[model samples]
Target chain A: MALFSSLTPVFIAIICVLIGVILKKTNGEKEKRETKSKPLSRPWVDEDLKDGTDHHLEEEDVDEEWQGLDENVAHVPFFAERYSEGEMIKRSQMFYELLNKRRSVRFLSDEPVPREVIDNVIRTAGTSPSGAHTEPWTFVVVQDPYLKHKIREIVEEEEEINYKKRMGDRWVNDLKRLRTNWIKEYLDTAPYLILIFKQVYGWLPNGKKKTHYYNEISVSIACGILLAALQNAGLYTVTSTPLNCGPQLRVLLQRPANEKLLLLLPVGYPKKEATVPALTRKPLEDIMVVM
Target chain B: MALFSSLTPVFIAIICVLIGVILKKTNGEKEKRETKSKPLSRPWVDEDLKDGTDHHLEEEDVDEEWQGLDENVAHVPFFAERYSEGEMIKRSQMFYELLNKRRSVRFLSDEPVPREVIDNVIRTAGTSPSGAHTEPWTFVVVQDPYLKHKIREIVEEEEEINYKKRMGDRWVNDLKRLRTNWIKEYLDTAPYLILIFKQVYGWLPNGKKKTHYYNEISVSIACGILLAALQNAGLYTVTSTPLNCGPQLRVLLQRPANEKLLLLLPVGYPKKEATVPALTRKPLEDIMVVM
Candidate 1:
């Protein structure tokens, strides 16, 4: 009994040491999580990470089927239209004049646009070049009034949250100047609501994932062509990226998991009362540096 | 001396406990750092962060000069050209057919292109919409042979490293199929190289940074318009994004720190022997979902 008492202090010290170790471990994990959860302060580092072209490293291996075809695909002769310098200058000027007239019209007319024009515009968009020719865009055209209203609901709900909470005062102020708010009346008023989706990854025939490299950039480029096509057809749309509403809109549109909403365009003619902000583009000298 | 001997075991035990606590603290810090350094495994989280539209939260407040304009800009009546339905369909179809012929031609001829055409196309691109109408694109046209060669050198060096080290086997294989390698002969051979940079943020009059929201996507959309204008003017270019070479190229070009290279296009006529991958685009039904 005397020996037991003597050893008690040593035993107690051992238990104390173990308790300290356990507490340290728990605190370490908690601190680690806190560090990660904190918004990254280094913008440059985050910007580098968001390069968007590093999907090859981010994804698993795709199937050999399509890739093998890439190896064997024949290279065909490409012949482009050749025009004289005068003709080239004239065509470019005319095209520029045509495109310059395009404005993001918010007050859309409910007049029905020919469906053929929408299809043709989308087809033109599909011709856009992609990373390694991986066409990773899907255009969802909603003409039904009910579905458009539902989309408006999803978009407005999220946008309201964005305006009320997520968006700062400057952003709200900027939007206010643009005459834009969370309430998007054009969603229902436009004849068609084109929701563009970028497939981040594709599922292979074997159920494996195929990474779409530079998909966002590629899809945005396609949208640019789509805008041009719409202009050519005398159509107008206000390009919108509904913040924090991608997942809900994707599910509402019945799109698959790999698809992500990139841009939403309400396509139609502008109402007679439609007005746009009197904006001027920067002169060529301001935007271009010739070396 | 007798009392000191009796307390020796207890003192040793107390020292051991102190050592344990110190060791645990050190280990905890090391583990916390390790957790922070690990590549984030959650993609959806990363994807959310990559939403280019979230710059308002990411940047500091800008001086209120231009933003003030956004608030008070006059809403003028926007009059658009209204075409008959048949003419609209025809125009849209014609535009599609024209864009459909556009291919990513790798073998570009050294034929000099009209500078006026390039200017007009850039003007057209400037007309494209942006987030809060902040035109965040810089089109750097390199006509000097020496500078183009320097750009090519920088691109090739980084590309070689990417091919060998950063890119995995599958990516290498994918590019192999596309017949693209680190040796970018077109950079030197093409008459002009248009390097597109997205000004991540603009400098306000007060020297504070003005955040360009959705800069990457907006610049890309402008690029789309640029591509359309190029096609209209009978110019050919292969859109290329030189990975890991943006910083070096930016330094060589003497662009400001705010500008980051988004895409580099080698612009000219296609080589008579220019061949593109014999690829077919998915049909309209495949790409478009109509509701």
Candidate 2:
């Protein structure tokens, strides 16, 4: 009789757990259906609201002025061409392969490239999105032999100081595998040296200055695109930042004081025997978190 | 006779100018032919080199140790499939057009997004190139409702203070056209809030710090890729940087002190009636220089 009573309680417990599992699965399906039913909803819209209340009007007075401001601005109709899912995957994979081949080459050839090619690459880079559309960047192309030689000398001088003094022992040690030194023959050897300058603020016609927001972040994004464009053109380049050469470079390039040197790119073909250190990228699991 | 002599000198000068023009045209053609004949030259090989000296050996002493260093490190063979030039252009153009369609939306839908979609987009973002391939970035995905609500409240508090006190009058005026306010409902409404934290330095197994290079520039590139990836996935997102929310967010998220907040992205579908500001990008000529 005791064994029957205990067994009866265990059977009841199992039945309750099964019922709970079934209910949970049903709720999950219901939630998914609800999500699909309304992929996009605007509760703030007056026509969609069940209650006869316009919530937008309840905002502050400053926000009311914003609507008037929007009216003053002009907008053009825009429609993007949609691609099939398969097409998107193909394009993404192709781009990934293209970018994968890009490497920073130190040994650059002196082979002359057409000026039009450089112009097109820079234009492609300018297509990068910027903060508030400020486009606070300037791409200066240097091909003059004298100017290239001068830049090379100045960069070497600064880099020598950096290698010996500015950079800590550990920092220098980390760069050992890169096999780089104070000597930068590529600066003069490369046919083109594109100097990217970040504009801190804009100069108005009235001689007043307008502030640029997220200038550093915006310029960095543009530089990344610039590197990609150069590589896409089958050109090899290195992102070289010669410490303390900014002041001298500004004077040599005759740029305004408002412009700061952001990055220096020596673009050309890679030498036949050019080599890079073997480095492995972190696996995707180490860099991402999924919830 | 004197007038005839003067006319003869002028005619000779005009003839010389014509000859110079003809010579320049011929030189341009010859240069183009030369470039085409040897598009990619392997001069480092012995056949092409006039001198037997290999310039690679002349580098600094530390560089000699690099080949030894390569032996210690592991390498995986990488070969990306090549594409024709015409196909490359087509793909680049398609990508450019797709990215052009991406707009920063203020009104976001609260629609539920598939977890797998977010995972794929983040993985795409991780493929960005970093300085020395350090890949010093961490992506934090925030989806919990309570946590989202808390982030929204804190971001709003900081933005309100910024609009009133921190931002100068000129900066505020510039933002008037966008019709943005202190309120940030999208932070809570969006299904995912991706917080990108930059690792300034890494902690080794031995409890030593390993310095990261170009951390700011590296993170910015990753953020750009993240934006492109999200847009590619048919999702709308805005890069939101609400200053002064870093400290509180770190505490809430429980991230280490070394990780600095670089960018905050709220990803979701745009509201059905969502509208964006009409802003034009700078013309190509204004941002690029050719010499």
- On DockQ, the candidate that comes out on top is 1
What is candidate 2's CA lDDT for residue B150?
A: 94
The pairs that clash in candidate 1 are none
Candidate 2 residue pairs in clash (backbone atoms < 3 Å): none
lDDT of candidate 1 over B17-130, digit per residue (tens): 788778777876776555443222221122222323234334533443344434678889999999999999999999999999898888998988889988998899998888
Instruction: List, residue by residue over A1-291, the lDDT tens digit for candidate 2.
Output: 646644544555455455555555565575565433321121111121111112112211122111111235554443333455555555555555555667667888787776656776676667666655667899999998999999999999988887887664655666677677889999999999999887765655454554456666778777776665665667778887666687788889988776778778998877765776667556667877644
| Residue B139 lDDT, candidate 1, scale 0-100 | 93
Q: How much does candidate 1 score in TM-score?
A: 0.86
Q: TM per model? A: 0.86, 0.69
Q: Which sections of candidate 2 miss by over 4 Å?
A: A1-71, A75-94, A111-117, A231-233, B1-95, B111-117, B231-234
lDDT of 1 by residue, A1-291 (tens): 768767766787777777777777787787676554322222212221232323333342344334433577787888788999999999999999999899999999999999999999999999899887779899999999999999999989988887887666666776776788889999999999999988877765556666567788889999999999999999999999887788788888899867778899999999999999888888999999999
| Over 4 Å off, model 1 | A1-69, B1-70
